[model samples]
Target: MKSTMLSMLVTLLLIYLSVCLVVFLLQRKLLYFPTPPLLHFSPPMEATKVSFENGGERLSGWVVNEGRAKALLYYGGNAENIEYNITFFKDNLPDYTIYLIAYRGYGDSTGEPTEAHLYSDALHIFDQVTAEHSQLSLLGRSLGSGVATYVATHREVDKLVLVTPFDSTANVARSVYWMFPVSLLITDKYESAKRAPNIVAKTTIIYAENDNVIPRESTERLIEAFSHRLENSILIRSADHNDISEFPEYAVRLKRALN
Candidate 1:
């Protein structure tokens, strides 16, 4: 009976290890959820479609209200159709030109999506736009917050805004799967908290009052990490993680933050 029990325990251990390996291998597949590209917009907002080569990969996005001295670079969420923001940008931020990048694999961009490539493409876009705009700001929401945080650490952004942001992808994953060794088994760990200290840009972090996606603790930890340069942190009352952008208070608070 003792030997049988020992064998059962060993079998369970092997099964657990196998599950961990599988999670490690396919972590990115679970993390990034790319939606189909929206090719057309109704009542078009007079934005121009643009494309550039980043490491030979064609990255595509929309550029709205070009020729403004002040500019905003927007990094969108996972599964987000970035083109949906065209009208919002046109109406709310008329003074600044906005560049909304569709992540590789999410839109017309031709490349697989990963943290390394996303950060690289962001840097490329930043460099390309810097010469044209005198003052450039950054806005990142959800998964894009990771990419945006990485860019803010490396580049010279005037203002940085993170919406529904997490302290780190690994931390969030670990919280979600406490029984598993997520930290050891995950790739593309967007450790935003680790990079927050180096960011010199005036920063604003926006959170939902009832965010069901990213845990409030993760967001609070990220806020604490930015104790040095965080200009403001706002929570949109009565908003959830996905619907926060639809609220009037969100835009109002965002505009205030940028100003």
Candidate 2:
């Protein structure tokens, strides 16, 4: 009977080890999906290549609508390409010159992507754009919203728009992965909540009413965090995680914020 009990214990230990190994391999897919690929320049828009020198690594992006009335710098979500977003700007917000910054490892940009690297790349783009355009606005969606918030905290700008923004990456992870220790495991913190209070610019945070990916409760925490820290701010209605920009209210809110 003792030998049988010992065998059962060994069997349970092996099963536990096997599960751990599988989780270790699949964790990356759960953490970071839709990795960037090779560049495919758009055929329609007039794209100008802008290269920023970052510690011997060259980060590249495209400036769409180079010479326009105003300039808007957009830092996109995790699974985005400059070529795809060019149409959104050209079709909807053509009044402003658009800079489509491809995060490192996304689009034509070379080098591995990390939270710190992407934030610094955005600052470099902002410096170059501010040199030319008198009126400048910053926009970010999803993951890029975190990057945008960082920029808004540091710089003086006309308007700042964060679409489907989150309070912090750790907050979201806690909501989704309550059973796991994702908050500790996640490498990219993207702690927008800690930085939102520092934004002095006119800010508009557009939260989706039906955003499944980012819990509405956490978004409320973000809004409250903003109100407690920042002075001028507004929240838009009927915006979702991906389709908030489609609503006409979004454009109206943007115009109001900028003006």
Candidate 3:
């Protein structure tokens, strides 16, 4: 009987150690992700480097126009360099001045990426853009939606747009890992659904009908949170998470959102 009890105790210890290892691995992933180099592309807009308040980091982006115009600041997804988005911005709206922020650790920028640092970087970029241009229109896609939402709530802006956004990282965690307690584990809480309505600017929430990563249903929940404050909202048919800009409807909806 004593031997049997000893064997069971050993098995339980092994299982606990395995679970702890898994959690440790996931925590590291939650903190830092690899950022690939910016792909070379022909931008219809003029490219420039903007310095950040943080002495070490600088942002490289495309400036659409030199003249005074409505400024559009774009924040991109986790893995993408905002430089890749220049063609979409130039083709869709040439009249406006667009600043596509290439976040630190991505697109030829210096320094490692972290949740708090990135959020602070967004504010610094917004302050610079707002100083340069009077009318500021903020746009965010996927991971950027969290950054944009945070900015909109804190700062004054003319327009706000969120593309392929989820309700919150906590909810997304629940969906992806229902068996595990991810809310307690996740460090970066990109809670767009909870924060969007606090924004007083004219807002538009666009979701792709075919988005697999952030499902259409989650965006609907996001809309419900912002329904009272949002100026306009729409769903682009046949648009997937990564390829929403490929659809003509995206441009149309965005143009309308600007107005």
Candidate 4:
């Protein structure tokens, strides 16, 4: 009877360890759902294709209203098709040029996505394009919020908007994978809270009331990190993480912030 009990304990231990190993190895895979570019996704608007070399690889995206005096650089969600916003910006935001691009391994960009790579590429692209526009605003949604926060901290951003933002990827992962040691296992710990205090840009944050993907607590934590009062912190009623932007109030608030 003693031997059987010991054997059962050993088996359970091994199984738990095996599960942990799987979670560690596949963390990024579960986090990033990169959507491939559509070849025939030509919207009925005029947009200039922008391509540049970063670390010997080509990075590409679309620029609408290219010669405008101001620019808004948009960073989208994990599984977002950025081209979907082309017509909206072309019509609604005539005051500023819009820059929408995919991260590496997403859309038509080359290479793979990583926290380090995304941060590096965002800053590089911002520097390259800043010369063309007098002022630059940044808007990041979901996972892209981390990338946007990183840029705002490092660069001189005129305005910063974080939609469905989180305090840190580690904390968010811990909330989801509470059974495992997610903090130690997570590689891309986009620690926006740590960088928030450093950003002096006029900041606006909008979050969904029913964001199951990123808990309400996470967005609240991010809001707390900011030193000053946020220009606007509107909560979209009845909106979820994926569908927040679809709501009329979401666009209305965004237009007000940028304008």
Candidate 5:
């Protein structure tokens, strides 16, 4: 009886270890869900295709209303098709040129996605647009918020808007997978809270009142990290993680912040 009990315990231990190993090895695949190149709403005739080389990788995206002195650079969610935003920007923010960035592995951009690569690409995009535009604002949603926060800390941004933001991806993962040590296992720790203090740009965070992905506590923690900058954070009362953009109030608040 004692020997059978010992064998059972040993088997369970090995199974747990194997599970942890798999999770650690394929973590990025779980974190980043890159959508296939978008077919619908390809860059409209009014927009220009912008492509640049970063570390030998070709990155591309659409630049709408390209000649304006004021611009908005957008970094989208993990699986977002950024081209969908062109019509929204064309109709509402006609005054400023908008650059919807296609993160590596998403859309036509070459190479795979990683936190370091995303940050590098974002900086390159910002620098390329800076020559044409006098003032630049940043908008990042979900996973892009981490990339946007990193850029805002390093660059001179006029305004910073984060949608469905989190304090840190590690913390968010830990909350979801409480049995594992996700903080230690996560390679792309987009710790936005850590970089918040370095950002001096006028910042606004938009969160869904009923967010089912990122916990309200996580969003609140990110808001707190901004300290005095918390004055501008807005919550869409009837929205969820992915559908916040559908709300009229969300667009109205975004226009107010960007303008």
Candidate 6:
């Protein structure tokens, strides 16, 4: 009986270690989806194709309502194409120019996506956009929230919006893989929660009532981390993480936040 118990314990330990190794090796693949532009996609008439060079790689995207005094830069989810938002932004926020810059390895942007590269590229994109528009605001959703927080902490931002955001990628990973040591295994720790206190820009947080992708606990933690009171905290009722944007309140809340 003693021998059997010891053997079972040893087998479980090996299995746990094997799974940990696999997760460590394939973590990047799991985090970044690198979605290409959708087929039959049409660029909004007001959108002009623009590109910026960062870390020796050229990243391309669209700039709408160029020369406007107010500008908004949007950073999307890990697997998002970002083009899907061009028309919506063009229609909603006429007062400000819209920037739909793609992450490296996403859309027409070159190179692969990593936390370090994305953060650096975000700053580069911000500097490029600053040349034309002085009043700049940032909008980030899901994984991009991490990038936005990093930029907001390091740069000067007038306004900020986070949609379905998380406290950090490490926490989210731990929530999913409770059996594993996700904090140690996570390669890209987008610790937005850690940097929230330093961000002083007028901020708004839009989260789904039922966000399965990012637990409410994670989102709430980020909200509580902010140093200043949020301008708005709108919740879309009966919304999931993926379909939250589809809810009618999504665009309405976003428009209010950006404006």
Q: Rate the local accuracy (lDDT) of all candidates.
A: 0.91, 0.74, 0.77, 0.90, 0.90, 0.89
lDDT of 3 by residue, 1-259 (tens): 9999999999998887687568756764754454666566656535554445464677666676555568888888878767667667777777788887677787766776666777888888888768777798889888888888998888888999998888887676677666666776677878888886688888888888888887666788888898788777788888888898888888899988986
Q: What is the lDDT of candidate 6?
A: 0.89
lDDT of 4 by residue, 127-167 (tens): 99999989999999999999999999899999999999999
RMSD of 6: 1.5
Tens-place lDDT digits, model 6, residues 211-240: 889999999999888845677777899998
Using all chains and alpha carbons, the TM-scores for the candidates as numbered come to 0.97, 0.80, 0.88, 0.96, 0.96, 0.95
Per-residue error for 217 in candidate 2, Å, reads: 1.5
Using lDDT as the measure, the top candidate is 1
Candidate 5: tens digits of C-alpha lDDT, residues 144-253: 99999999999999999999999999999988888988877899999999999889999999999999999999999999999996549999998999999999999899
Candidate 4 segments whose C-alpha is farther than 4 A from its true place: 227-229
* Stronger candidate by lDDT (2 vs 3): 3
Best candidate, TM-score:
1
Candidate 4: residue 80 lDDT (0-100) = 92
Clashes of 2: 1
If candidate 4 were superposed on the true structure by all CA atoms, what would the RMSD be?
A: 1.3
Report lDDT (Cα) of residue 257, candidate 1: 83
Candidate number that wins on TM-score, 3 or 5 = 5
